[model samples]
Target: MAPRTYGGLAFIAEVYLGSPSIRQYLHVDTGSNLTWTQCFPSSHSFVDHIYPKYSPEDSNTYFDAECETTAKNSTPKFTYYASTGVCSYELTYGDGNLIRGRLAEEMITLQTRNGEFKVVYDVYFGCNDQAVGNQYIGTGILGLGTGKFSIVEKLGSKFSICFGLIMESKPTHNLILGDGANIQGHPTVINTTQGNYMIMLEFILVGAELKALDDPVQVHLDTGTTICHLSGFLFNFIV
Candidate 1:
């Protein structure tokens, strides 16, 4: 499905969660690994005007890790709140944005080419009650990363995104999850030891000048990072 854009910086998608479902617009962040949304009874959060807060108590399938139990002999595998016995998480962005809350599980609703459907996966998502930073254009982030707790890994480890160019008029981009991604391209494969998507850069060509690098540099393909960063030597040579 195509995601809505704001100021050509943030991409937003309409996502539904829980039983009975609460629809929310969230930022589509390929650089992140955890999906989270502001929940009701928010105490330290910046109010989001576009979508309503999610209340886990309203859903029958919602299970707070701190207050519930999993199968016998099986401990909750993800991070949790030691004080409350609930799974909890705290995210601190480079820009000083922070979100802290409990980790929970619930059914996620999606609309695919086959039509709308609901998948009851044991998703590890944050239910944030405290969020602080710049005013977010969307309610949450839809993390598309390689981490074990990421939505991609939880949903079987395959997804695709086709970014459309931004224009004067509002434009949208494609985000496909699961088996129907249908990515068409000549793939350049690289192996990595990190959780985030990383690729090796051999060299860079500017105009007609081929600037070769002394050594290959590993760069991260991050959707959440707005600006491209290069080493001092590369940046100086390029400019």
Candidate 2:
């Protein structure tokens, strides 16, 4: 759909955690969970995988979680956008890579319905590439969106997480977490169905111009989806 509005909730540039002594960067994604990272492997760690060591000395926010082995395997069980959810989480992003590790009890900063607070939980923090520099968003993801395991889903009440996207030439756009506060006044077109967690949407294009259809089409608005897509037939006509 042709998005309107330039500002709502801004993408979090930085997030803090742990005592004043230790903290780290993390990427907030609404997609998947099973938070993991690379840590010092004991005799149990596989020798085949390339594990980037996490050292407390180098990072100001590094702290010991006293983690124990939950499970281990050659490949991850979870899958998001082609990456497996092996015990050792191996993820290849566009420019950086991540290696999965175990979760430990440590403090993490997250925003809730009440406000922002630090909560101690196990996090995956091991697969950082040294060449990628400080690409970490803040220790791990702040999974929000409508996904099953999102941080927001785990919350007891209704709350929201905002995601912002930058347009090529036009102004930026903000995707709301709850009812979409930015588009509050605008005419919000939504499609709902049974047994589905998401609302479907269809952008109406008439002639050579893009516009909302008199009757919006069916679509799934999934925060977990990496990109917005249209069917081949519809796409060709729209373009």
Candidate 3:
């Protein structure tokens, strides 16, 4: 995996999708819940034309939830476009970027240590027809959050990622999923509430001074964000 620079921020991973298998460099966003890409009929959007657009018609394993009755009868539920009556999605990012498209399921290929493997899963991804803003520099985003539509949640309940320092010349990183994510670490048990991984931060230590927080602060661990965000009071205290 290589680091892709976007508006001064860097992201990792280049995922291969569909039967023909188009490679797309995407943001490995742990804070997001859905994985999507620019698809056919998205000429209006300012997408990278260098990469080929994904065509549902090209992949035999591709299934559209709206058009196919069998797909609609499947276990997973899908949202529909009000006017078109097609299964669709509309997403608005934190940076004010927006995307509108239909939902689809297709085969995904992954490169593993053993070898390359293919998995046919019900991938709930948007086939973007419209996109706004320059926040997205790559083909799409790889959602690693805890939502049902997230890749981690859909495949399994396990995933691990190691971030590299920006100053490193050739930074090394790892993105392990499923059984491969069985590596050990300094473990801390946390609760999952409101579709987020939350931890209680009791206090902080600066130099030799120990600062105890009045109340335990709830912090969300997000890989999508580049920097840590602190409350005004916490910032002042830390400063």
Top TM-score model: 1
lDDT value for model 1? 0.72
Candidate lDDT scores, in order, read 0.72, 0.38, 0.70
Instruction: Please estimate how well model 2 matches the true structure, expressed as its whole-model Cα lDDT.
Output: 0.38
C-alpha lDDT of residue 46 in model 3: 60
- Candidate maximizing lDDT: 1
Between prediction 1 and prediction 3, the one with superior TM-score is 1
Question: Which residue pairs come into collision in candidate 1?
Answer: 65-86, 66-85, 66-86, 80-87, 80-88, 87-103
* Residue lDDT tens for model 2, 205-230: 56777755455557754443345677
Tens digit of per-residue lDDT, candidate 3, span 1-239: 54333523656566778877777666788777777777776655666656556777777777765544324332224576568767866677777887877777766776665767656466766667788877676777777777756778666779877766654667666687776786567886667766668899988898988899998888887766677888998899888
Error of 3 at 100 (Å): 1.3
| Per-residue lDDT value at 126 in model 3 | 62
TM-score of each: 0.84, 0.46, 0.82
User: Candidate 3: where are CA atoms >4 Å away?
Assistant: 3-8, 50-52, 66-79, 82-85, 205-210
Enumerate clash totals for all models, in the order shown: 6, 25, 0
Model 3 scores a TM of 0.82
